[model samples]
Target: MAGPGGRMMMGQSGERSMDFKGSGRRLLRQLLPEKAALWVMVAAGVGSVALSVAGPWILGKATDLVFAGVVGREMPDGLSREEAVEGLRERGDGGLADMLSAVDFTPGRGIDFTTVGGVLLVALAVFAAAGLLMLVSTRASTRVINRTMYRMREEVQAKLARLPLSYFDQARRGEVLSRATNDIDNISQTMQQSMGQLINSLLTIVGVLAMMFWISPLLALVALVTVPLSVAVAARVGKLSQPQFVRQWQSTGRLNAHIEEMYSGHTLVKVFGRQGQAAQEFAEQNEALYEAGFRAQFGSGVMQPLMYFVSNLNYVLVAVVGGLRVASGTLTIGEVQAFIQYSRQFSMPLTQVASMANLVQSGVASAERIFDLLDAEEQAPDPVRGARPGQARGAVALERVSFRYDPLKPLIEDLSLAVEPGQKVAIVGPTGAGKTTLVNLLMRFYEVTGGRITLDGVDAAAMSRDDLRAGIGMVLQDTWLFGGTIAENIAYGASREVTREEIEAAARAAHADRFVRTLPDGYDTVVDDEGAAVSAGEKQLITIARAFLSDPAILVLDEATSSVDTRTEVLIQKAMARLAHGRTSFVIAHRLSTIRDADVILVMENGALVEQGTHEELLPAGGAYARLYAAQFAQAVAEVD
Candidate 1:
């Protein structure tokens, strides 16, 4: 049930805690290839922040100019600013005199509209330049993010192609697919949302801090006292939420795997009356995902408000300090106003950076999953210049070969077989007898642990996998069809361009032409991966037709006729008899009657070659093959009765 198996998967996944710092660093390294673009973005950000920082200071001057003109009005007509301040001190209004001492005013003057307008124009220009630079920074960040994700996707795809088949055996298909699709997309979104803003925010903090210190060092220090507390909040919350993010993505993968498995086998579930069981499993996985997602979100969500609280505290501190300086006449009203703005500017970016913890952590979590895939051990590479026999003679011989999926439990050991050119070898065995595994070894889907296999006296391992597989054609019991026309599906097997006539010829040879002609579109009928337009037998026939179209020197048929009716099966057998006459064919079958005319029949039991001879020779020997034939014959007779 999903309740226990899913928990076990979560347990296995949770065993490795998230390396938050390591993953973040690796994500940054992903951008190294786009370093030039990042530098452009950073330079633009710095310039924008610099001008932005100066705007407040410049605007404060306009405030001073306006205030000075107002104060100058209604003053005595002939007194200088110093004379008026002295006059106010003598009149027992020392507070006004102190403020006047700091204010620049001309006696007998009202607000000067010309000077005020000029300062306002300068302020507008400064801010507009800052905005234009920000636009440039944003554009550059977009280029960097897009290019980086483009390359990352390409790398992930290529990595999947290089991974060994054994890796997929151990990994869940939907989980791997999610990592390649969903996780990569998540990473792309994270960069898109965070990269440019983070750059601007960080540069804003630096530029704002400089202006704050230049205005008043004491107030700047007062504003900075709460920064350590903000940092502590961010780090602690990030640590708590980082593992939750990792678990969330893992849960997503497990849930996806379950959905894919159930949906793919829904027909079987219905036949077995397991709908309740399936729904319960789905509910359990969905619940696990909800919990993980909630915790990760709530944990990271705590940081933004905390940072806001810290920013407010810093704001209050700067206002109090700046107000005191203004009252004492050490700083002007405009300077204190500008200093208050600078303090806010400094704290806002910190809050933004703190708030980004969620996106950053989630993105890094996905990056780690993708990086794990990229870091997995790849299958051994082919030789640069591999051995190539000019033409394959269809001679394959295994010498003392051995293999084990698990190191401790051997499946096949010291098994050897040789097939001469143009020989039809029928391999018959029980379910766990390694009959299909023999074909896999010959095709080099897996590497043997102990011995070597040779084709035409040249080592198979020395030959490129592409070259080796090109000479052999395989039709599995499990059929697959992509989304395309039926004719195109058959043509997939051909290495070069194939005509419509060739596709029809292959279909006829596989006995599929009659049924295919009944369809509305005949060879041109469109079918998806499920091949729902046709019966299971027709799907199998299409795959068999594909193999026929290839016309390789060697053929591997693994229960290839199992899905068809007996009449169709007999027709396929007759066709195979004609086509396999001069080809080296390895046929694995459960029905012994199908291989009665084989040149030789090899019987495997528990990974050992126990009997080998013609059907007539082995049936009378009274060994493993004789017992198997007797059991099947008895079953057939009893069914008839």
Candidate 2:
């Protein structure tokens, strides 16, 4: 079953199996580019097939010539050892001695003066042509496969960038990484091998069958007796092994996810003393992967031996019938020889097909997974009408807005609020009181389920998502830093040309300049993942600097100082005041001291605002705001003492 956000659910029964034929064709179409070079490669494959069949026939004809001279009374038109010997005997009479002296000769096998040179010439040409065609086909197919893989990788990466954040929240990072890297590599390998071998094998089988029938229909019929049985066995094995292969890949992804989690949280695990439990859990996942892999591989491995046994049985029957016909003198020994060669050729391709069955099956499984992701619906389209810079007034209004992450439980219920230009409004609440949800709606990360939000009389849904986001600046509680210089991080969202002096000024306003200047490279120093090089307070300041650089008409501060010490909080509050100047600001905070100066304080509980007033007004009213203020103030005082 697929869960919300298109995540697959695992169970004892496993997910529904995919149709290999349909999935394979669809994947191949997507991967192959629409270009003339691709068509040329296919044409080369066809030519190679034709040349391969010709090579085998030429070899078979040479074998027939030898068999004719040895067993049949009639000599082959081409020269034989006996005929060459006779020619040498005639040449020894001294009339042709001069001609013989001009050529180098080997003593073991005398050559016929008339026909040996021509036969050797034809044979050499046949082998050379076949080898040349094979080489061309191999090269062309490899180029096509590599180009196809390059396109697939590019598309997958592009899709990942465009996918909504909610998709990442539900899907495992390790699994997505596995699909893009390991699974796509497998698909490319399969395409290369299958393209080369499948075409060659099919041509070999067809060519061998045609020759066998031409030589003797009875022998051809005898050799084909194993075809149906081989196909039936292979089909059964493929069906049984397909599900195991899928399960093996699924388990591999889970194992990768577990290992990534454990490695990333090593410090937390040590603090909690969970080393032994983590090791045991890892061992269990390893065992599960091993079991699934073994079952899938074991089933595929038995196919070759089973196919060989059936082929040998058919070979014996062909030999007996061919020998009986030769004894009755109705068939020449050369024809019997040709028939035997053709029979082996027919069986050989079936053997190859059997061996490659598992490769094909695994490729199909990978294709199915890849296609599932490609077919997922993308985020809803943004409005086509472009946004122009409006008047600097930052009035924001929400009219009966309602939202729910899950339909069964509403996070914000019919809430409406308005903030005039240059107003500093604070939303105070406990955990899960719809504070962050309100910010998310205002940023349009998630759409409102019902009602409308307008900015300066423009409906948010009617504006381009990019334009909407660009006009608002947010400082989140969790600050994310990319691997870049401090100057780059501070100016991340600045669209206009911003000078180094301007970046430094923003950092100073956010109270981050003193610490940044002391670093080894100052503004040029690179930050590690999530700014691990800096303390949490420093990271918060850098985020505030980024917001300041954007110079947005509206500012949102969501628990911006929640994780910092008291002194750092005081510094950030000063920076916040500077940033909030002349902008419509919305602050969501749990600490009472942070929001005490808000021009309007809205108290929310259970998804709705239960009270609205200034700090002084709310305290005397003794409503939800007063109760929250009292509780948080007591905690702050105890910490201070």
TM-score for every candidate vs. truth? Answer: 0.96, 0.86
Candidate 1 contains a number of clashing pairs equal to 0
Deviation from native of the Cα of residue 4 in model 2, angstroms: 5.2
Q: So what's the TM-score on candidate 1? A: 0.96
Q: Candidate 2 residues 1-641, lDDT tens each? A: 45465556322224667678898788778645745656666566666656655555565455544443333233234655445445655867343333223223333423342354465567678667767777877887788788888888888888876666566666777777777877798899888888777877887788778877877888888888889999998999988998888877777777877787888789899999999999999999888889988988898889999989988987898899988766554455556666776777777789889878888888888777777666655666787785544775788999999988778987788888888988999988888788887888898877899999989888888888888888899988888899999999998969888999999999999999999999999999999775878988899899999999999999998776767788998888888889999899998876778778898898888778788889889999988988887898788789999
Q: What lDDT is reached at residue 528 by model 1? A: 91
Off by over 4 Å in 2: 1-13, 66-117, 322-341, 386-389, 496-502, 565-567
Instruction: Please report, as a residue range, the 10-residue window in candidate 2 with the lowest summed lDDT.
Output: 95-104
Best by lDDT: 1
Show model 1 residue runs off by greater than 4 Å.
1-11
